[model samples]
Target chain A: ADTGAMAAARTRQAQLTKPLGALGDLEDISVRLAGVFGSDRPHPHGVAVLVAAGDHGVAAGPHPVSAYPPEVTPAMVANFLADTPAGLGGAAVNAIARSVGARVYVMDAGVNADLPPHPALVRAADLGAGGRRGTSDLRTGAAMSRDEAEALILAGAALARQAVQDGTDLIVPGEMGIGNTTPAAALTARLLGQDAAAVTGRGTGVDDATLERKVAAVRAALARGGSDPADPLGVLADLGGFEIAAMLGMMLQAAALGRAVILDGFVEGSAALLGVALAPALADFLFAAGECAEVGHAAQLAHLNLKPMFRLGLRLGEGTGGVLAAPMLLAAAATLREMQTFAEAGVPGGGA
Target chain B: ADTGAMAAARTRQAQLTKPLGALGDLEDISVRLAGVFGSDRPHPHGVAVLVAAGDHGVAAGPHPVSAYPPEVTPAMVANFLADTPAGLGGAAVNAIARSVGARVYVMDAGVNADLPPHPALVRAADLGAGGRRGTSDLRTGAAMSRDEAEALILAGAALARQAVQDGTDLIVPGEMGIGNTTPAAALTARLLGQDAAAVTGRGTGVDDATLERKVAAVRAALARGGSDPADPLGVLADLGGFEIAAMLGMMLQAAALGRAVILDGFVEGSAALLGVALAPALADFLFAAGECAEVGHAAQLAHLNLKPMFRLGLRLGEGTGGVLAAPMLLAAAATLREMQTFAEAGVPGGGA
Candidate 1:
């Protein structure tokens, strides 16, 4: 974070008509935004949401995130492409993004099923139109090869760079997969050096029995090899999903380009854990859109030392949390960018 | 809360989808909406936001919330009436309400200046069309006569009842006044039986010297007596502002009509403390729009034993906090009201 920009923003915040620190996270948000973008009260120049869709072999595991069939992944992706009303997650993201004037890009980083070509879709350039057919079951072996992982990551980085070049100020990263949380928990546990039970959670809502099985799966995945935190590619290849690696790559690229990235939820956090291992300074460019309902997410956020902007009980993935925050970030930016200062408004302003 | 409605809602929640409590406060919110509107999935039938505008003599006190002059109140009120580009609490409320399909009502509970005549302004029938100029200085004595306080309460009650009759499912009560937090702080301390120092905060943004003076003024008001919590009306006459009293009436009436009310911030909370003394069950009908940016709000909320709906560090009270949450509440209600149940969606659903 640029300390000079932050200092300037803090001074500007004090000059606003409201009390010092009265806007709460909004005040911090504007200040951090200033630091990240190197401008006092930095608003998004343009907004884009990247939804990374993939598949996980863990859906075939004993306990899946939900009872929905694995086909739901491709079905929801198709619906998102058509802007159809799917209750899973895509519809909410589409509606919220439209409401906030954000462009939506659905990427098939890796999916087991074929998704029809759409203008909004991003696919493997070398592998042709269809997405890389995601990762295999983590319970058996590495989800992907190191080469495939690197390729998918570079693809994500390319997308992030493109968005920044197109004058996109903020990047919202989300994920959609049948049993993605399984690898997410395993990855979080590996990176944080914690027990699987602490990191595992009911993904779409499960009973105690399914939750137990899910934890056991994470424990099983850890017992497998190539789970070392020091080796970023090893972690991605061994246990992480293609969508996670891709989004992680995007986060790193966004940070490198000095573009602010607002996180979606636990899946994003899981990717971020790997992103942090790869680049510790990535934390400076990130903001939590909202608190995730997933239990491990709070721990993940704490590990990252990030304060989420709001706690809306939003467990939905697909950048919906980030979409909810676009208006607020704009409002925070507007407070400094548009609104008159106390002196400007001729309102008596006093502060400590 | 209606125990039967809550019970029914809880049972429905278990069967609908998600985990035992995956939705967090959203689960509680749905259940409470059930209690208020008497349905398992009580979505808002309609929405109305009442912005109560008033003036205070405390603006001229030793410590002012801001350096802005008193004339800014009526000037901004006129700006709000004209839908001008003043970025105070009113414009934020207007934009947020327009974003959602919520109707907005600007009422002149009391402003000291001669507010211009506007079609949207609500004034006492007896006081005629131009609107009521507000109370005397609280530094010397009562802000308004007991009769006027009662009249203001009745006026607020009438507005709430009218909104409910007009098919308004949710009521958002917000207030605007310079140095209003001073009286709000005094009323909170009086009702919660706390010290002035504990309850006082810098309203609209005041310097340390002004904050100290504000605290001393609150202490002096307490010393003037008539602050017994048991006598809610006496407390109102001694410490509360006109907008606070009116909002209190509105809350009480809304509760009586089995309607849900979302509170703005500290001013609303202060009014609610007295309302709780009048009718303890009013807590069930109320949802905090956001955590007030004011320091004294936590104590008031704790005293009421009500968890706020959201925490946006929103100290600007023009129903803006509630406006931000309108979308969330609708989404929560829609989740149960519109989405297919797990069994219906052909998904696995289990809860303990």
Candidate 2:
């Protein structure tokens, strides 16, 4: 982030036509945008919602961790890419992204099935050598090799870099992995040094029995995975899903490139935890979209110290929450760049 | 509210691609919107933000209740109508409204000075016979006569009815009265039977000394005003500002016309309290935009049982908070009306 640009933005905010600090978070957001864009006037030409899709190996056992079948992952991936009558894609994220004028990009991190080629789907080949056909069961061993994890992260970073080069200024990192929250809980618990039972939540509206199973899965994954908090990549390879690793990469790269990234729900926040672990400064580039209904999301946000933009109890995680918050960033940037100062408007009593 | 339509909306929400209740407040918003529009699919054609501006005589004394001078009221009224280079108006509300595709209508319910006419300005004559040039000191006497109070509400209702007739499906009631919070706190304290100090806040960032004075002003106003909660009109006439009365009318008429109304900040919520006092059913049509910085807003919302859409700490009360929330209503309606259902998308396992 450009400290000079941020300072300039803060100065400009005081001169805007509202009482000092009256705009609150809106003022903070615009200043952050200025830092990210390194310009006094930050205007995003393109907004992109990246829905990373993969399968969770822990969800495949007889006693599954998720309420929905693992098959739903690939099915939802197809749903996300499918065009609807509204001209938006077939999913909730697509509708919201369309409403906010954001384009949705479906990333095939490592889904189990071979999805037919689609224009919107970014396949493993595009993600580079780290991408593979999902992962082995995390309950037994590491989810992926360290090399593969590194490659996946690199692939995700490359995607974000390309999007920025293509004029996309804001990136919303979302995930679509059935039973992914099991890994997210495990990751957060391990990173924050908290109990798995405390971090675990019922994903996709699981019953009490299923929730217990999910909690056990998170505990098992943590026990088997590397425990070193410093080795984020090693920990990620052990317990993280392909999409989670990819999202971590996307956050890191987006921040390095001076672009904005909005994180959706628990799965995305887990990815952000790893991103922040790898590069503490990555936290500066990230925005928590909302306080989702997921139990661990609040804990994760508290750990990151990132105040969510809204709290609509959203638990759906295909960039829906992130896309919904994208407009706020737009409103912030517009207000900062366009609103007249008290002197310019010939109004007495300046905001300062 | 159309109960059948609300039920249909609830049912349809379960069928959407996400899990049951995963959308949280968004689902509730869509259902309520269906109830208000009397359709399972409620698409709004126009979103109008009514910013009612008035002066407060209580701000004219030696120890003013507000940080800004009372003259700032009419100046802001002009500011709200001034054109900016971005094609939006000159104020915070205008920038936010323009970003969300909502039209801003400045209502001069009572300005202390003579104002030139503009296309966006709704003059006093248009507000009916109850409209006057500001309000007297509530600490000394009644803010307006009971007749004026009733007439102002009727005029506000007429404007709301006309807007609905002109294809507006959403209405946002905002206010711009310097020292307005003083009157608002007094009215709330009287209606809710609470201490004046408990409800009074630092309006527009008052200093410690000014805050003391403001609280004292509220206490004096309430002591002189009517205390009966049953006679809402009398209470309003005794302590409410012109903008607050007009906003109360807007809420009543908007609800009656089946158009959704978003409440801005503390001043707007105070008006909403009066509206709900008059017609308890009006609660169904109102949405609290955000948790404003005012100390009394939460108390007002708690009384109304309305959950704010967001909490960006906004206190600039020219419909800015309300305008920012209009987009969420749009997104909610679009998701309900456009997203493909689980069954329609050929995905397995129903939400039930």
Candidate 3:
């Protein structure tokens, strides 16, 4: 597609009756989309969020820094459904989605335990509904087979397409997999061409010693996979979790369907990198919501050449950052769609 | 006056299921008020914003790096009413007032220009409506007479009382004086028990040489006025703007009326120090919105021992910071007012 549409959108966005570039990177996203779609008015509709829940295998080993056993993943998932007080569950997401009018769906991509029949949980797993009891043995073998990776991607695309058919126009990809940051780190290393140490940090506030171990584990996994940075699918099959692969597919499908996708924190950024790798054109549909304060997030964003709208030092990874950033997105969209242009409002533009 | 009420409020705020202290200082303010007023459910209904517009006499002299010619103050005030496309006019306070649903009133305490009649402008001057054009030889003479200082305070208090009668539950004191940062720095130095050099900083990004001159000018003014740190009223008469005096009165009246006040950035914080100096009890009603990033805001916040809710590096000094913070206040209030207790919700409070 010609970049004229995006350029026009940029012009329209700039002509809004506010300080130029004061709304921050949100203005950038809105204008870029305007140009991409060749529409002065770009409406964000059909908003959907994908929450991927999984566990880490390394937690089975004794670690002084690791808090809570891997069993907490399923328990938290149940809390999300039951609305338990103890759970850091989906309440924040539920409240934010309601506030911004977004539909949310939870995907059990690789949770160790079988999720009982629930309305919120969609069985979108690719590895035959169940995986190993704990985290994937990434050091020795593939996280999931190529077939499993393909299934997950297809399921995510199908879900996104269904959302579009159901009158949804925007997709926000979120993840809920424990120890998922490990895969995210490895993905960042491969995509950004950085060492594992550069991309690895204390996940969930690990101490210095445990951080070293986590970095070593990620380095070992990268070596075991013999991953090719140029081949995105091979990287996913080897190092990316079901959730990351699914998110990447959802992003690509959203772009194909001409829907906007609000990319969440580091894990979602990893998925976006993969999506851009698959179809470089899909990058236009994605908006970097905010920079995750996680050590690897900057590396991932730099790799993709994307800037986030806000910088509140957010590192929580349950799509919370995306939801927090929704207000800015709404403000940008409102500015593009509602604010009067200079020509229409009769406000003089800079020396035309 | 018992601290237990404040303690109970803090406990209630902490138990509301959000991250511990994530809401920051606003939570502290709400909890402290719950104790002061002896009510678990405190009301924030009486709100008033005082914008004091003034000019600095020192700016008329040879200054090396001042972007604005002192005449810009009145011109900008007029621009504020003109509805310019650049948004360079009208105080940011106007937009903030609209955002937070607060009643805004502009007071011309001491502008160098002869003002015309405007519906929004309240001509409550310290030395009568049309006194000497700006301060008289402040480097040699007194900044304002004690009577004028008292009148400014009365004007602020009178506005507060009117708002209270009109059913306002909270008051937000704001200012809009150009070159007022000079007086604010002197006031901060006195209250913080620091030297003028320690508290003084470059206002509006002045160069190092100009900053040194500004610091020297403030020191000369302090020495000339014999400004007493022990007596806030004496300091106000010698080295304060009409707006700061007005804010001091407004804060005292709000405390007397049992209403809460959301203080703005550095300028407002300087006024708050004066208010607290006049009547220590007034501190109970004053909530420091946050430390302003502009020159001497940190010193003022430190003097008050107050913490603001958000730190966005804001220094736009038109009550914008305080207005932006109103949403957080609403959030804190809503969390306390709407959230159900464990007993009411039939949920276990970690005892299970």
Candidate 4:
């Protein structure tokens, strides 16, 4: 983040035709956007939504942590590209992305099944080699090798770099992996030194029995994985899914490229925890999109010291919250760039 | 609200490719929209922003409750129509309205000065007869005659009816009257049966002294006006600004025409209180855009049982919050009308 641009944006905000700080989070958002773009007048033109899909091992076994079957992962990946009358894909993310004029890029980070070729689908081959099709069960042992986690993160960074080069100004990192929220809970609990029960939540609206299974799975994963809070990469390898690692990578890379990143919900917030742990400066480039229905999302955002922008009770990931918040960013930037100054408008008495 | 359409929309939401009730307030909003449109797939096309500009006599006296002078009302009204490089008016409301593809209609509900003819400005002549240039000081006596209050509201309804006939699906009622928050706080306190000090806030970032004066003014107004909580029209005539009364009329008329009305902030919420008081069912067509910086806004929203869609800490009214929230309605409708159902996508397990 450029401090000079940020300071300049703040000064500009104070001069706009309203009271100082009257716009609240919007004023702060505009300054943050100015810092990211390194311009006092930042008008972001393109919003890119990256939905990383993978299959979670815990979702495949008996007493699965997820409400939906594991095959729903690949099915939803295909659904992300399926044509609809709305001129977008058939899923929630696609419809929302269309609403925000954002392009959806679905990545097969580590789906259990081979996803068919599609224009909107970013193939696993586009990512580096030695990527696992899916992770091992986190409840029993390490979800994946440390090498695999690193590869997925690098792959995600590569995708974000390409997006920035393609004129995308804002990146919304979303994830779709059945039973992945269990891993996310384990990772958040381990990193934050909290109990599994404290962070674990019902994924996909599971029954009480299934929710208990999820909490138990997270506790088991933390006890067996030998993950360390000081080592984010190791923790990710032990408890994070491929999509989670990819999202972390995307956030780090997008921030490095000076583009703004919006975190979807709990799963994405877990990835953000890892990213922030590795690079504390990453917090400067990220925005928490919503205080989702997930029981642990608020806790994770609180840990990151990032205020959730909207509290729409959204629990569905795949960048739904981020896409919904894109226009707010546009509106904030427009306020800074377009609105006349108090002096320019000849309005008086802004003692603030 | 159409119970049949709402029920059908609820069913459709459950069948969508995500968990039932995952969308939170968004799901509820879509259902409400369905009830208003009488369609399971309700898609609102046009968003019309109505900004009622007026003056306040309380702002002219010594120890004014407002930070800005009364003249700033007409100045900001002109700013609302000033051309900018963004191809919209050079104000926060216009810039935001442009970003959301909403049209801004500035109505001179009762401006102290004669606003020149402009395409964007809706002259007072268009409203109705018996309109006052501004209101008497609420601190001393009734704000306006009963006839004036009734005329302003009826004129507001006429403007709303015109907007709806012109293809507006959503109405955003905004207000721009200097020292207006004083009246709004008084009305909210009177209607909610709360004390003035509890609801009075620093409107436009007032200093400590100005805030004290604002609270004293509200208390004085309530004591002298003798406004009945039961008679909303009488309450308006005694304590409401012209802009606030007009907004009340606009909301009532818009809801009657089956269009969704998004309340801007403190001033608009005060108007909504009156509208809902007159027609309790009008709550079905209303959406609180944000929990604004105003202290009384939450109390007003709580009384209406309308959960705000966003909380950006906005204090500047003129439909900024409402315009910002229009996209959320569009996205909510898109989710209902565009997304594929689980049966259509061949996905399973929505036990919710």
Query: Which ranges in model 4 have alpha carbons more than 4 Å from their true place?
Result: none
Ordered list by TM-score, greatest first: 4, 2, 1, 3
For model 2 the local lDDT of residue A219 reads 82
lDDT of each: 0.75, 0.85, 0.65, 0.88
Most accurate candidate by lDDT: 4
Writing each residue's lDDT as its tens digit, candidate 4 over A7-104 gives 99999998899878888899999999999889989988889999999888888877889888988898898889888778758888887787668988
Q: For candidate 1, list the clashing residue pairs, or say none.
A: A347-B67, A347-B68, A348-B66, A348-B67, A348-B68, A349-B67, A350-B206, A350-B207, A351-B207
- Rank order by DockQ, top first? 4, 2, 1, 3
State the lDDT at A128 in candidate 4.
Answer: 82
lDDT of 3 at A196: 93
> Clashing pairs in model 4?
none
lDDT of 1 at B1: 71
Tell me which of candidates 1 and 3 scores higher on DockQ. 1
Least well predicted 10-residue stretch by lDDT in candidate 4 chain A: A123-132
Candidate 3 lDDT for residue B300: 72
Q: Which window of 10 residues has the lowest lDDT sum in candidate 4 chain B?
A: B123-132
- Model 1, span B146-188: residue lDDT tens: 7878888988888888788888878888777777888898898
Cα lDDT of model 1 by residue, A103-182, tens digit: 77778888877667777777755433235576777887888888878887887887777778877888988778878888
lDDT of 3 by residue, A259-312 (tens): 778887888988988888889887777777667667888877776777775454
lDDT of 2 by residue, A25-106 (tens): 9999999889888987788667898888888788886888887888888889988888788884778888888777888878
Scored by lDDT, model 4 comes in at 0.88
